[model samples]
Target: MSRELNNTLYQSKSEHNDQELAEHQETNKRLQRLGQEVLKLEAKAVNSLAERIGDNFSRACRHILSCTGRVIVTGMGKSGHIGSKIAATLASTGTPAFFVHPGEASHGDLGMITGADVVLALSNSGETHELNAILPRLRRLGVPLISLTGNPDSTLAREATVHIDIQVEKEACPLGLAPTSSTTASLAMGDALAIALLDARGFTAEDFARSHPGGRLGRRLLLHIEDVMQTGDKVPQVTPGTLLREALLEISHKGLGMTAVVDSTQQVLGIFTDGDLRRALDQGIDVHTTEIATVMTQAPQTAPPHLLAAEAAERMERHRINALLITAEDGRLIGALNMHDLLQAGVV
Candidate 1:
């Protein structure tokens, strides 16, 4: 092609690329601004709740605390989803609670509610037909009702034993048609109630662990060192007079990277680990000729079998060690564990 034609084509391509890049940058800026606006609005809605946590909030908490039965949460549509999460939080945080779909409540699920139970109802407009329909029955059953709604004048709020105003100036949705900020406000309010009740009941981490035994937190809090440590034949050990080469074999066979040097009575005299081996080798000592006691770490840190595995993990991290010897009150080596065991058990 001619030089003139080539120059024209390159200029056109360059202009097109520059235009596309500018448009892409503008689009990114618009998207980010929109996202930031939503966050600010939701944050404002949640913050507004701080002032509303007054007598009514306390009354609602008292009702739940006094109830003998579970807290029954009910709502419609998006409100229902938030209610389910609130119920779960309440249940996991020491309050017995469960969600009953408002729609289903009219269809025989209302039986789930009783005079001893407390009802927590959620609605942005406070006029959800399905949710409101169950309110009369809840009253007839003499159940205390705690309503969270954006409209204080609505029927549900007026009938509630304690009404928490979850009003938001506007929704996060640009169209102002969705349940954006309102749902967020409701969720924050629910979380506040759950945590307050948790504190009032003196709920602890151990209690939380009992409710969530299958989760990582439960494992860390509830698992004992005795549950994770290698016991009896699995524990690697050698006498204090054993050669370093033999101790190394025991470490290899047990796969814990260390072995306990114990007396005839199974009392731990010292521990010889891979780090000790490295130092002994640096001194040009023969593994076959050196006694394990000569190179072992004396008075190594030991954990009781009843210690929480999570505590053992923390101890190991603090001391920069990989293995631990489990000893009884009498200083007898009963078991052993390494960092890998903690990791496998999800205690780390």
Candidate 2:
């Protein structure tokens, strides 16, 4: 929308004029119709997927599930890029797989293949030059083959042990030269394959986190405070009877902006933060002679050493605090972590 029209519609600060109101209503109607058209198209595409799940697709799944070695995916053009991502999804979801570009397979990359591996060939037309060149070698090696193509009777399909058809009547593109609907179909089919294997393997979040340790989901599900917390002598701790001034030295030395007041056995008694210092001065309490027991805040927020770093980060942010004392189940301070630790661990 143009800025002038947008401001007239939204920034008017009152109901629009009669003529402007009619124009706005007409524009909204037009946008609604466009949304309806897109929904209809997407519904047709998704339904095509459900309808295409037949015995052939089942057979292909069975073949892949029974395979002892990796699934070697290959394709030409748009199918190739989709094939690469599909292969990656399969690998991450517990199905061993990798994509080999058909063009590269003919240019000395064929050595990566073995007789034990299954070749998953993808092409809209089922006829690609580079793929044809490798078919002879694949046949010689006596490897099982799977074809994903629009044409069911092409040479590649004819030689395959299992053929999965991805036929579509038209391209989503207006020009018809660009691959759009066909690519969408191919990518959806790839997702179907990955999801099928993902369910079959009973893959859990932990399994996925093991594969993607750098991702946000991995950090949320796999990272624990014990893995990143400051433990032992580095944790700032002071006895409850310690003078307030002495606790300040511990906080400054530890640089966590807080000090834990504990008993002789190290069980938590209370905590004092930099904020507590400001309040003490306001109340005219002498830091030098006053015991931390008299001024320390009881029931300070603490986290278990086993809690996820992300969960701890959320708790701290919600409470508007920077640091948390990691305690054992018995309330003994085991470790400490602050906002900076989470940032360094890439879990923030």
Instruction: Count clashing residue pairs per candidate.
Output: 0, 0
> What residue pairs clash in candidate 2, if any at all?
none
lDDT by residue for model 2 (1-348), tens: 899998887756555566688899999999888667655664566568778788988888888898888999999989999899999999999999999998988888998889888899898888887887799999998888988888898988898988888877776655667776777788888889889888987899889998998898888789999999999889999998899999999999999999998888888888899888999999999989999999999988999988899999999999998989889999888989999999988898
Local lDDT at 305 for model 2: 86
lDDT of 1 by residue, 56-143 (tens): 9999999999999999999999999999999999999999999999998999999888889999999989999998888778879999
The models' CA-based lDDT, in order, is 0.95, 0.88
lDDT for model 2:
0.88
Instruction: Please give me the total number of clashing residue pairs in predicted model 1.
Output: 0
Measured against the true structure, the TM-scores of the candidates, in listed sequence, are 0.97, 0.82
